[model samples]
Target: MFFVTVDEKVKDAGPDDLIMEIPKLGTKIVCPTYFLVLPYEDFDYQDEDEDYLPERKYSVAIVLNFWKHTVRKMKDNETRYLPLLFHEVGMGCFKVIKEKNELRMAFGFTDDFAGDGLNIDRDSLEDFSKSVQSIDVLTMSACSPRIFQVTRKSDNPDEPVVSFNISIDECIQDVNNSRNKLR
Candidate 1:
């Protein structure tokens, strides 16, 4: 679940001015945050093997907006505000691992293009994981552009895996900065 806090003091505040706070987690996210939840059953794959199914019941997506476009599009007396609304700066996935007693959050760029990917070390990942486990909330974000396809040399060479270009450390710093501003 997501909790939004609007600063009434700011007159006509934009998206950036709004604060998103995760309940039970004191960190205040300054960016405009959006969440998308998808159930595993919603997928239409016809795999007969039950073991192949995902263990988690739901997958949560976190989308952050950093900027808004000035240009607006109008069509026959109707204004369409979709992809033109906000500039998505980052995105990530969240999952709850009941067996491991951990909240897993993997953050990356919205797409695989543009900025160089950020590498995260084991220590950083563990620290962040421990911090969020208290609230059982997993969060991820990526600061990159464009999503594309790539081939991997793993055991299943034919299978494709999605990759991101942002580091969890950077996302942590952003949250900390926003929390400080709130105080």
Candidate 2:
């Protein structure tokens, strides 16, 4: 198992950027490439029912596609205890925590997705590994045609989000070269 840590010094990265840059040097994102888990503090979201509010603060996790499918089946929103594993690559969790005046971000894997919130079934890891392998690129593409589509928010015209023009293959090469280092 492997663990990766990302700090604020890291630049704003897209899905492909994150995928290629984090995992094994020679591996590829044969399955789903991105898992953008936007926690409440970093982002603001209003559901259909305005009265209800999700109490959890801002958090984000970028895991392998298999973990994503496994998590989807679990049908819960708590992400604190999710262990993200990729056979070809490594494994880790994406965490955003507060450190005095700054918010520290890190990504990596451990023995289990341990948290106070929920219990993770250790056996399910193997099951998820086999399940996601059957998923082909065509299915993944159809599921997310534009895996990373960045655009300026309508409300914030002056403040623009950064977008990358690099191709997936190019991003993969960049990742291969960097290994665990965030470029």
Please report, in order, the local distance difference test score of every candidate based on alpha carbons.
Answer: 0.26, 0.28
Residues 1-183, candidate 2, lDDT per residue (tens digit)? 222223332233223333223222222221122222222234333342331111210112322333334333432222222333222232333332322322222333332322322112345544333323122211111222243222222354233122122332343343333333432
- Tens digit of per-residue lDDT, candidate 1, span 15-130: 33344444333334443211111123343334333321112111101112210110111122221111111123322323222212112332222322113221123332233223
- 84: Cα error in model 1, Å: 15
Report the number of the highest-lDDT candidate.
2
Worst 10 residues of 1 by lDDT: 66-75
In model 2, what lDDT does residue 117 have?
20
Error of 2 at 90 (Å): 21
Give the CA lDDT, 0 to 100, for residue 76 in model 2. 26
